[model samples]
Target: MESPERARLDAFFRHVTEQFPAGAPVTSLIVTHLLSERPAFLRAMSATSAVAAVLPKPRSIDQHTLEAVQSLYPVHDLSRELFADSTRALDYIEETAGGQDLVLADIGGYFAPSLSTLVEKFSGRVLGVVEDTENGHQRYAALDQLRCPVISVARSPLKDCEDHLVGRSIVFSADALVRARGDILTSRNACVLGFGKVGRAIAQTLRAHDLRVTVFDKDPVRRVQAHAHGFRTAATTTEAVRDAELVLCATGNLALRQDDFAALRNGAYLASVTSSEDELELTPLQDLYQRVPVGEQLTRYEITGHYFYVLADGGAVNFVHGAAVGTYIHLVQAEILAATAALSHGRFEPGLHSMPAADRQAIARIWLGHFER
Candidate 1:
């Protein structure tokens, strides 16, 4: 495979940065997934100049990326501490800022537990927040009171490209896991739960690998889109999982709960592309069956004589094998970089805001020009 286009990512990130000048530089508490092209994006944004602390997600962050963050922002000792304990990461925000208000560059809305808690705990100290990821957007949107301008790129068209690539990465990891079990891909029919951008992409990727894919989503419109795209659609989650040998959850909510696993196909491979707790639950397995370890990241559990294999310990399967998506990682990171810079300007009022379409268009234009050239 070709190497990740880090040079293109660096250039594109710098281009995005140039569009939005950091008006009044403010100390920021940043949370991000430290993976391919991320370090280059941060360096291009001159992230250290405005960083107070950085909390790299434990699931996605690696030693090389951690070292890069260390070198980029050598001044902050808190960054390391926060990365170690993410709960403490949110707590540090409440304690620190030294007097000046801090900007929060959040990924996945890890800091925002709820609307009331966020408004109660971090109103004045946090001047504004720049958020990415659909999960984060939902968390911030539910909040009625806003003390700071919350800028998000989760719903932007620019992010959709990255989400599609993310779905491919999810499928890549799932295929690898199943293959590791000595199973052939074509022998199993796959079903994707959740027909959003990522879910649609997952279904397509599965189909590309010669798996007859069936998809299900809570949204009827998404199901219609899936059918229109030449894929099978299920009316309900049970209908989706009952016949498929491989079931992948892309819904960013608790999709497969304790009882829901009962509807799964016999000896099915279960995996998710989003948060483990949010997408799949293992309480039924833990309570009913003895844990059987088939592999380091794979587990086998028997329910009612039906065997189910859980991948990546019920966490995001895409993240199991480094989730290498080459240059695709840069598109979202560039939008995130731009959003951070725009939030740093502090021009937006205390409310939820989206990444401007103009900015997204500008980033996409720059991205296509650089990579496609």
Candidate 2:
């Protein structure tokens, strides 16, 4: 009997193939963190038989797992540094692709300084890029004269599902933290920075856990929405950090800086639910604190007569600590595959574009039907 995960993977692939015929010859480049949860996607893409190269995130997954997946498809594991070093990444792409067109990437590919240059150098040979993160979506907005169409999953309505998963993961991470460090979350004052979908979900979850939650967002509209939702809204980041025992940064932007760190009360715990480490601005704190390992996923710092705790080294706490999003990622992955099909078979104008609503609905319907049963 097929496993449930395999069954769902097959169903998702069938759905994509129905919309866009598979086996159409194309060359593609994929840059993403290679987690144990990614094999399903690798299998789905292999079914298309696209000539592909992968630049997995540095040290994200073990070489044994990568080797197993590579055996199933003609995938070249470009150097791990490729994702961080854009010039090297682009050079490898140029050499490996040898004129193949489609590019699919997560945060790294979207924010690479050489992206615009790659599109220009490849010219009409490139189909376009499919970006899957909020940080990438923000970076896409700043690019001037993008040469090819950009399909952004971050902008799609399907992101609500992703945010919901993030909220669930945050709760799981919070529970783990409580178990690791007792009584920190029980009726304690906590602040969540940002009122975006992820942040809103987190605030709700934290409140559900009986933590007094205060939400802070730079946008007045979001602040008003938080108030409407019956959550206290902080006027400034400083206000949110002051006296809060727990803080979560979900803004996907730099929400905390040097001064904000200075405001943290002793024994305060900070974690980033965002994809990057920019959430807490730790550069200036490097010299001020003596780092001590608390656990595999946490660090304790002695700074200025107080102890500060950071979860997952100021990165996505749930992910770094092995709290899997599990099947919630299936729908998001389906959306990505559907977007890839659309970009391969359809034409798109340059600039950021949401996944077609019809495609989004179709993907959602499949997952909803399965879960609803």
Candidate 3:
């Protein structure tokens, strides 16, 4: 007998297939990280005549999974073959598409010149894209020219899955940090840069761990929100880090630069909760300061005679150190799948778009029904 959750997922997939018929041929080029663990997503794509090629992040590829993916479709590890060489990746995608209607991808496909190239070359053949990351959405929105619809989970008002999932994961990361660092977070002052969804969540998680949390965001509205939430707000990033024993960057944008390192208190642990080194400007920091590796994922930097520790090499602390949020990510993936189906049905216009409210509600309902039980 099919489990209730499995039945619901099957019904959803069937509904999508009915709405977007295979006769129209909705071929897709999916680029993402951690594809192996999400078997349901892969199964849905396999059922569709639309799946053309899958490009997964190299770090996410395991030997067992790589074999499985290769047996189903042409699988390319994006980090190894594509990310470093977008032009080559584009060439591979163009060839694999082979005149089929191409649609849908994650952040790995939507960033930089790659998306522009797909839009230009594929034209009407390109239906839409699904971007889940804030940085990717910002990049796509800034493009002066866009040919297909863009559905962003990051920007969706109705789909609070990202926010909720990130919030839960932040607590996990905090727990791992506390365990590893000998209760440094216990009753200590921590600053969270960027008062966005992820930042606010990190602050809340820290507080739950008995840490005094302060938030810093350039946007006044977010700062006010943080203040209203009873968390202290810092006027500037520099001010936030100066006295903080722990600093977490959650702004999708670069929140800390090499110069900002000078402001951090000695022995302060700097970590990122958004996307990796981008939020903390790791390249410049490494160039400007003497770096000593504490472990595979943590580093110590000496600047101005003060020592500061960087968690996960300034990468996402939860992903690098703590357990993967598998269940939460599966929920987000369902939203992505729904958006892809909606796009295939030609329900959106040629611009950046949010996930349809109806879809968000449905996904949320199903998710809540499963978890609430």
Candidate 4:
């Protein structure tokens, strides 16, 4: 079989530039993708859009530098392929470290700044890890976790962070989490709050699977958009939760105040996709509200006649609980990001990297493709 890298690049050359004339005013193609394990790379991408951004490496190159450089050779088209290979490249890749306690880091889309934060927060706890890119080496000075140093593609103790956090709760293994997702998404009437990026994505994903969706947002335009998209839109977060069987907080705002719980119904599931669950002010809410634990990771918050179930303590439920995102989505997004960044002279840095322009375009294409079908 042709190498994934070769196939991806070949596809890029064959298809990525098909829109423009062979010699149109188009500039370059910037590429970026998810590295599965390394958080640093995603962080780097988030920090600054660079040109030819090698995962885990940093430089002062700017977008103008990319544009002035004539054309961009997007790295994601190749880097994602290379990154996917790194794990299988080493035999001892999955071996665990010295500690019995495991540390799972799910650094989504290795960009720079996010990756740096990963190095700072969890490198010391490294036992074994499944890094999706070569950037993992920058954070770990030694490959001590590799039991058989010479063997590539070996099992590493470092698990994907996404595999650990599920349904706003942490699971010890991927199997347990998978089982949980099977049950969670099957629940009736899930409510998604904060019609922002994460919220919208979650709602769309649920709807794609035929799950009933009701979205809430403070922004009038967003509410209108959600409603227009065939989702039930609520004017207030509290009202959205009132009828929801499950409540997902996707907003970046501090909306889930202690008093907010007072409005929730009994047995409703509450999960968050934002940065912090503490923003829910559970302690103050707990004072007046009574929530009970249901499943291993599920909680039941008793509010008036309703019981609200909270998952992952309101973290990014999809990231925490769901299985690996579909590879097709990842591939499309990575390719688009790479192409766009390259055109603008920015390299795809890893770690909380911004959604690449090409990837965004690709999303539009995918949506159009689906619509046309």
Name the candidate that leads on TM-score: 2
**Poorest lDDT segment (10 consecutive residues) of candidate 1:** 74-83
Once fitted onto the true fold, the runs of candidate 2 whose alpha carbons sit more than 4 angstroms away are 1-4, 22-24, 49-51, 58-67, 73-86, 108-111, 321-323, 368-371
**Which pairs clash in the backbone of model 3?**
none
Question: TM-score, each model?
Answer: 0.87, 0.89, 0.86, 0.44
Task: Give the Cα error of residue 327 in candidate 2, in Å.
Answer: 3.0
Q: lDDT at 222 for candidate 4?
A: 90
lDDT of 4 at 297: 57
Q: Candidate 4: deviation at residue 271, Å? A: 1.3
240 Cα displacement, candidate 4 (Å) = 1.6
lDDT tens digits by residue: candidate 2, 214-260: 99999999999999999998899988888788888988768898777
Whose lDDT is higher: candidate 3's or candidate 4's? 3
Which 10 consecutive residues of model 2 have the lowest summed lDDT? Answer: 103-112
Q: State the C-alpha lDDT per candidate.
A: 0.74, 0.71, 0.70, 0.41
Ranking of all predicted structures according to TM-score, beginning with the best and ending with the worst? 2, 1, 3, 4
Show where candidate 1 strays beyond 4 Å.
1-8, 74-91, 114-124
lDDT of 4 at 253: 49
TM-score of 2: 0.89
Q: Rank the candidates by lDDT, best first.
A: 1, 2, 3, 4
Which residues of candidate 3, in runs, are more than 4 Å off?
Answer: 1-23, 58-67, 79-89, 157-159, 181-183, 321-328, 368-372
Pairs that clash in candidate 1: none
Candidate 3 steric clashes: 0
- lDDT value, candidate 4, whole model: 0.41
